[model samples]
Target chain A: MKRRDFITATALAAAFGLAGKPVYNVLASKDALASKTGKRLAMVIDLKKFEGNSEMMNKCVDACHSMHNVPDIEGAKEEVKWIWPEPFEHAFLEQNNQFIPENIQNNPILIMCNHCDNPPCVGVCPPKATWKRAEDGVVMMDWHRCIGCRYCMAACPYGSRSFNWRDPRPKIKNITANFPTRSKGVVEKCTFCDERIVKGLEPACVVASKMYEPEAMVFGDLNDDKSNIRKILSENYSIRRKPELSTQPEVYYLI
Target chain B: MLDKIFTGGKKYWAWMIFLSSIIGAGTLAYLHQYEVGLGVTGMGRDVTWAFYISQLTFFVGVAASAVMVVLPYYLHDYKKFGKITILGEFLAIGAVIMCMTFVFVDMGQPLRVVNMFLHPQLTSPMFWDSVSLMGYLVLNIVISRVVLNAERNGVKPPKWIKPVIYTSIPWAVSIHTVTAFLYCGLAARPFWMSAIMAPRFLATAFAAGPALLIIICFVLRKVSKFDVGKDAIQKLAVIAAYAMFANIFFLALEFFTAYYSGMHHHTQHFQLLYVGLEGNSSLVPWMWTSTVLAAISLYILINPNTRKNEKILGFGAIAVFLSIWMDKGMGLIIAGLVPNPLGYVVDYTPTLIELTISAGIFALGALIISALYKSVLTIRRQV
Candidate 1:
């Protein structure tokens, strides 16, 4: 009878320790894990929709810059942009060899940082000031550590990194009040809205996907079987810009 | 009148005046850069490096080219270069000073130049470059002083100084080699990412640097009635010619490899430079100009007739020097980043702030060179 009582006590302890926790605690842990689970984030951009919808690209740009604190300069050509629209021919000069379109009015893409798997910028940084995160493979910059040598600027084939020749923070609207501002003498690039991602919000550009209806932007973990991005990759044919560079760019487009 | 001035008092003031003007201009430019910032320069995001770096690169080669003179004069005991060995060494000192200042002015924050030391990154070629440059400066000063003092006394230099001077020969080569390694080691930039980069840098350094020295010697001969001698110059020009030959060969090899392989990524940069890839032919004119100048200079140097004339030879050397400077220092490295990874053609232009700062730094270098040369000339006159 004593042995049976000891066995029952041990079983209860094991059950509580291994499988049973407070409901709130369990929910919080699950929420924390929801971000990391093999959701290889990928994009499937439909080029066909971009054929006539210049406004769609502009809307996406507005949403991204507003959240990311991208300043709008008077001369748009001189502006430092995280994402901006480019004509199809200029955007795909290497690939569009002979397929000269009669009417090239349609904007091809609003390309920004590719966030390549084999990022040349990260490889070239002398001070480890820039790095590619293993968690999500997003390349990030540490402004304080940068010496403004511009070697990484030479190293990056993507032309993704922008040096703050002047202080960019002042030109930014009140939006930068909450977000951190970059100082002069360092490189800056797109971070996929890391702050929003941490808070369970999608990238601002991805959230603004509704701007295009026929084939809106879709972002999901590439690793997860149920993620929308993985599903699209399997279902559709897409092309990555400058694949010959072997940078393995994460951004893709679908026609 | 020329002989009197060369042998007497007026020469001292003239040297000082010439040097001070060059240095003064540089200081003024630097001040403007400090007030406004790099925004004044044309340097943009795409072409992050510009004229400042190009000058720095050319000067580094000039600094290292002293090795050619030093090696033969010191190691081989080539008495023919004995009189001018000290001159080459002093010139190197000026070149290095200019090179260092150019890099400093090019920085966004000149105040934070020391930060490179405070937070050192061993992986960076720049860190190694900094260390090597400092080492070279210290060594050059010590060796130059010891030799100059001995020359003044009409006796052999201190036995200890011989080893140090000998050591500087290789150290001279290292200064520029490390500078070249700075670019070549980087794997991402296609123009710089080649095993041949270091060799090419050395070749260009030997050619352009020596050629520059020859021109300077000729200038001194004309202005101050100092003769470095035709024989010495002819030997130096031959060295420059051989180096130029190698530089051209390596460039051709790079062209062949990039084009013959037909790799799109590698070929794109070459196409951009020569063929006006996608209607952005801004660099084409510059590239062609460099090529034509280089060819003409090469022909002049290789031929016996034209090479014999000081006027023709001086012009040839200057042209070759400028062409190589354009090819290696500016166009090759800066224009490498076109049609960026996202396939966007971004243009980079240096602003006025950058230009002023660069000019100021260059002046600073000229000032140093002038001061050094003045001291050497003054001391030699006394002896």
Candidate 2:
């Protein structure tokens, strides 16, 4: 091609690249828009429902893991857990009673990020990589901002946060093209399924659990008393993990 | 200044080579760690920090201990410490540099350490720790240089050095207090959540820091034409004795409160250290050994007869040094993390690579200290 023609072609490419996507386009692709007024996202898990339905629980775990591309490494030493089972006694040790029923004590219950009103994890972070969203109560992690210091993991009382010890990409069983894979060293956990919640969809785990057992998982806005989670929590008395710490955990477990 | 370090005897060269080889090995280990990830170390999701942080904590005390000598000599005009004040300040310089290195090496994304400055979080004690430590480092470097230069030229130090020297006293205290705050403020770990952690840190620091100086002065006495003075050594021993008393007393208070109150969470950490929680007593042997060694050192230090015997005092000083190292570096650090947030006895033993990297950091600090000390010694000789 002639030099003049080549110049024109390069100029055309630069103009397209520079003006291609506006700020709105980038924000549109991001997770969770400002939550609706008077709506605070919360979840209620029925402890009774998980009994002898371990496979169903595994499915819920897999759905969230697969959805988020959480690593599938073996061994508890370097496990990167998002959502998993914890024995009732260990999960609520502060509230444990000797006279409590054996079934509740022996059985394991599903647990994840509480998305506390006052997140201690956010408080300790030297960089504000993890923060509580203003619109909703969900504690969110900005992957780009994280220095992978793991102070957040230490500050989290419930052991919700997980660090990418090694390159998580290799261990991720199903390379889900839909989600971004995390680099090694960054902290990650349940973002309260912010991406899906913003899209007006329930979390992957909730959707997966509903398929096998609808009564097992409930997720909705806690501010709306009529919402499914609020309704369930209101009817059946529920307990939160380490409530005395005043983290004001949004995740509740219904007996 | 550089020529003095280069013009060393056979022993000095051997020492440099030994430190260098360890540093070289450590650098290789760090390279491998940087290539892979922190997973190469024993650190996991449960015990997120272990060896690196513990080393940083130990050295922060080492760095802060400089103020003990600095404050006495500079602020209070304790002239006995005049001969050794530069020694303490120079040691702080080397220690702060190592502290910074350990923090850097511990990072998952070490390259992103600049983020601490770029987007600083004022609420984080870690931010203040970095600030105070770096500030104290500069304070020492300036004060030591001014004094050493003034001495070499047969003149008084600049007028400005007095206030800067004064600032270093509290600045030194702040660095360790901020480091203590790093653990104490963590509401999650019951072991480190006490108000006394900062005091505990200071107490242990005072004992360990001067105990180390006692040994270093002895080494200096033998090696060079210069002597740090017998009076300075004895005075530091007295300071160390009082400090160790406070350290042991503070530890006893921790035990008393935990056992007497019978708070399950509080007692659990002690159980983990002493008896081993849930059949995992890996730290039991180490803690008991440290306790025994500490007792022996205290006995030697507190007694009037043994304190007068420099040979016995040297032995006690070494004991105190190792005792504090075990307590600060191993026992205290891992104890808070073992019974992790979820009641898991997740043990953390630094991998070979981690050990090498840590050794490398120690060697690096020794190299810096030795080089700086050599320059100072030469400068003193010329005067």
Candidate 3:
């Protein structure tokens, strides 16, 4: 070892030793903090952008479904969805205000798993089959581990999760090669484009929404103060579904 | 004892054959469900849990109701209840079997049930529900077997058996409470979130369980000369009356809190249960019939003059059982889901396959009860 480098390292170790802390303690603390403050991804939906724009909404829906291989079942009872639109008033029933404009009240606002910091789905899962990821705040489902008990469905106040009522493979016209399709007898939901995110690509719906002049959605790590989602969330007046339940929903809807 | 179950009268054999046929059909339907998924059932995306879960809730109550007899006989040292307590224990065994079967059939992946135990989590109500149920089942089995054997020999039960019997009394209460916890813990379901859920479950369980036993006892006396005695029947009637009253009072409280608070989450559930919500009221008639029947049963039970007459008493008992069956068996599970999380009304109607599967499970329990009673009578007579 070089004499100068060896002496400097020894000196730093001695300083830490004198302070009754190990030299690795500093590195360990940084790593521990980093894990504790991992990325919390969130989505911001601009409701105004979807007003009377059924064609644009359909495009966004198609992109997400085709990419995810979500089946297009015939009836509402057997329907499966990763992301879908809901009526504005129905989406936020707790805010039973009478004065929402007629057009806005009836307009369909996109809804999916809020991916809450304190998710009820994760809390109710008996086998730990469904859990909120520590690194990304995505409510993940392990289909193999799941017993398809549907307790997660009951626990979700937003109706975000869907159970595979039948085999979904036959109904999928085109399968997304990168993403794995789910089997029957399992519960599933929006995984926040987990595969795409790892590849350093934005969610499909977010990319699709950019085709129009006014972008309808923004997706980013909520932990990043400099990210566009955080900035948009702070600047605009927004609402979340069933916030009184104290799930601390990450998804924001700008009306 | 082994031959006793097989060596029944022609009518008994005919009844067994009838149940066996239904169970056979249900087994076929279940196979279809297993090959396909829960899609064949009437349950859907919105009302996810329906008939099977409702039956589980009802049978769990029936399983726990055995304690009503056990507590009075063992704790109070009431001698009249000694003979009837065995019937209660046997009924518990039957009910618990039904409970387990309902759960198994309801499961989307029944094969993965072992995972529940292998990865047991104390925090999960479903885990504790299984724990309490299995625990109660084993307790009842051990207690009933040991005590019945001692009775057969015309001797005192072992000292250890006393503690086990005592444990079962509270264990009975725990099974129903844990079952209620399965529903009440879900913060997303406002209808089941009240603290009164456990008490209401217990009250209904006590009423329904003993009411069923009364009917069973009447049948056993006529057919098998196995009378649990006139005084025992009267005592059970009184117990059921009080429980039914408590059950009614709790229902009233549920109504008052939900309607008076004016919370849509709370009121909307009751609206679905009692009246039509948004003109889609499939369960309205059933819920009203149950309520009216309960009130009528309460009247008959409360009147000592009517309660003493065997025919009148039988009618009251049957009414109470049916009333509670409707309440827990249909209303409890369905009402929670009607105005679903999105505040949209979606009704769940059990399909023929679902109904058949449920009937099969019910029949299986009755068969177990019949066999166990036959064995009990034979062994006791022989000894």
**Could you give me the TM-score of model 3 versus the true structure?**
0.92
TM-score of each: 0.81, 0.92, 0.92
Candidates' C-alpha lDDT: 0.74, 0.87, 0.87
Off by over 4 Å in 2: A1-38
Per-candidate count of clashing residue pairs (backbone under 3 Å): 20, 0, 0
TM-score (second chain) of model 3: 0.97
Best by DockQ: 3
Sorting all predicted structures by DockQ, with the top scorer first, yields 3, 2, 1
What TM-scores does chain A show, candidate by candidate in order? Answer: 0.78, 0.83, 0.83
Residue ranges of candidate 1 with Cα displaced over 4 Å: A1-53, A74-77, A100-107, A210-215, A220-228, B1-15, B149-167, B181-194, B222-226, B258-289, B308-311, B338-355
How does candidate 1 score on lDDT? 0.74
Error of 1 at A115 (Å): 2.0
**Separate DockQ for every predicted complex:** 0.24, 0.48, 0.50
